[model samples]
Target: MRKKAVRNQLWVPIIAMTLLIAGCGTKTEPMVDTAAGSKQQQSASPAPAPQTPVETVELTISAAASLTDALKEIQTVYQTKATSTKLNFNFGASGALQQQIEQGAPADLFLSAATKNMKTLVDNQLIDAGKQKNLLTNELVVVVPVDSKVSIGSEADLSKPEVLHVAIGIPESVPAGSYAKEALTYGKLWDSLQSRMVQGKDVRQVLQYIETGNADAGFVYKTDALTSNKVKIAFAVDPKSYQAVEYPIGIVKSTKHGKEAEDFYNYLQSKEALDVFVKFGFTVPK
Candidate 1:
């Protein structure tokens, strides 16, 4: 009886231990790592900030035809500095240019060969008179074909019989022509040569006439005369005969890119641009 009781106790203890081991072996859910899970959730990408786009502004400059060569050089140098702005030039007679601006042409600035054109715009309120600057001075000269037989010493030489087609810019619109007329009138040679005159649209056109031999003699700015190898300056008209040939530049009142236009305006008046002007045979005023 004692051995049987001992065997029954041993069997009960062994069965209880086996059941505990099996319960441990049964499937169960693993503990969750809350800290690691929160870290993963926070590591998700954050919303990005909105960025403003930089825009390139195009500034339109209405300049006199005589300024072409200098401004072209200036354009090259300016692009290096103002990478954000693009320059667009509209070159013509100063009077014609101001008239266009008055009629709402798409111009940001007006660079006139003479002050009269600028005055028209100022009186009309298209440009602020106070903002204008007398940027340059020029001399009117008589030019002839490099290979011409004409002997021009002064305004009197233009009246010679061989000088048939004397080209001058249209006096009403072209500042160069106005200066020429004023100079010739002062010399008392205008009335006598009116029949032989071939009026051009601008000083450049007059230069072209002389270059192509369409005109025997023509009046042009000294700067224009230097641009062509086909024409030679005959003589410089007396500066005292006419109002000082001054170039005035001003910002248009209706510019959409006001800030950019002002920047370019300030650049033109800088030493770098003035150097280019001097290189092109233009005299920059102090």
Candidate 2:
């Protein structure tokens, strides 16, 4: 009976130990599987993509007022090729633009309506003379309001009594005005038409004077006249009467962004830029 009691105690201890070991094994298996699953998920995850930075550069241009339309279109078309570069334009009379540059107005490049203004800058050492190029030519013409009955078939007719008010740019600061002076002086009409003159700051303003009927006749570039439908070309001023109208473009020597300005200056000589300028009625140098 004593031996049987001792054997029963030993059996009870073995059964308790077996149950404890089985419980530990069941808990440990799930924990091991969960740890393995976490590592697998980490290893299988996709990597992040690399980053690419965009270039941020903006260029400024000081151009003749007549180039406004063509350059704007060039700016649009150039964006396809130069996606990171931006263009800012300062358009005004060529002489005025020249003065601004001489006075240190912010400009990366200069486009003048006349070679005379460009030569002045070149002489001032503000532009590299070697970099200057005459890119366009324009015809000076007489314009009238679309509804006018005036018969101005020639530059001589500008002195007619019936055409009382004639618009022109101010000669001291306007290249178009300087051209008109040259034409009238060539025809011996500049001295006679002064009392009836309506002056403008730029060719476009002269264009406005005709379009608004403030002046019975005005002289402007063919390109300027083409920009408006409210005015009609009464006649083309004889090319022999004035200096040939040329558009000279160059990069300013003081430009902060020389490379970008040069890229644009070069682009202006491209076929795409010529297309836009020709479409705007400017003559590209062959």
Candidate 3:
């Protein structure tokens, strides 16, 4: 009986140990599965998305100095509407700008005060011929200092001995000067006014000369004369006396911003831009 009791005790401890091992093994498997599920959930989560980039472009425009006032206002309106594109303007004599473009200057668009300058670019195929158009027209006039007593009533007065110095733009380059030459030649005053002439680089310079009293009288675009408070219109040249003064604009052929340049170019021909030009004393061409 003692041996049997001892054997029974041994069997009881063995069975209890086996039950404990089985419980621990089952719990461990569930714990491992739970940890694996958490890892799987973490691996299935999506990453953040990338952001979209903004579109932006810059265009450089070479325009005539005469268009300065109107363009300044137009630029403000354009920026308000076209927030992605920026306009950079280069204002100067149309002839000079043409030379710069011919020399490979980085210009996207060209606005000339006269068709002759535009022709130079077209002849060389520097501008997109199809995109070229006459945009505006202007009148030529004689002006004098506000305080001057000179009786410069007409184009003929420019020849009078009393008018010691008459300012005119250089005929070889300036459109205003070319107009002045045409009018003087047509009126039979070119030869007579030679000794009394003070040639200027551009129309604005002629206006300046008259305003500062450096010249007794000067010939300039009506628009340019209007900009100075110190100068007054003496007379308006008859339209028939000179070739029609037309302003033309075109896209430069080498421009990289073709779409943006075309957009701005078309915008300049819009009614809103035309209104601004007219307000600044420019006559929109038909």
TM-score of each model, paired residue for residue: 0.83, 0.85, 0.81
lDDT for residue 89 in candidate 2, whole number 0-100 = 93
The parts of candidate 1 lying over 4 Å away from their true place are 1-52
lDDT of 3: 0.90
- Stretches of model 3 off by over 4 angstroms after superposition: 1-55
For residues 1-286, could you state the per-residue lDDT of candidate 3 as single tens digits? 9999999999998999999999888844334688888889888996678988768898999998888888999999999999999999998788889999999999999999899999989999998789999999999999999998878889888777789999988888788888999999999999888999999987778888988889999889888887889999999999999999999999999999999999999999999999999988999866
| TM-score of decoy 3 | 0.81
Candidate 1: clashing pairs of residues:
none
TM-score of 1: 0.83
Instruction: Report lDDT per candidate.
Output: 0.92, 0.90, 0.90
Error of 2 at 55 (Å): 4.1
Clashes of 2: 0
Q: Per-residue error at 256 for model 2, in Å?
A: 1.4
- Candidate 2 vs candidate 3: the TM-score winner is 2
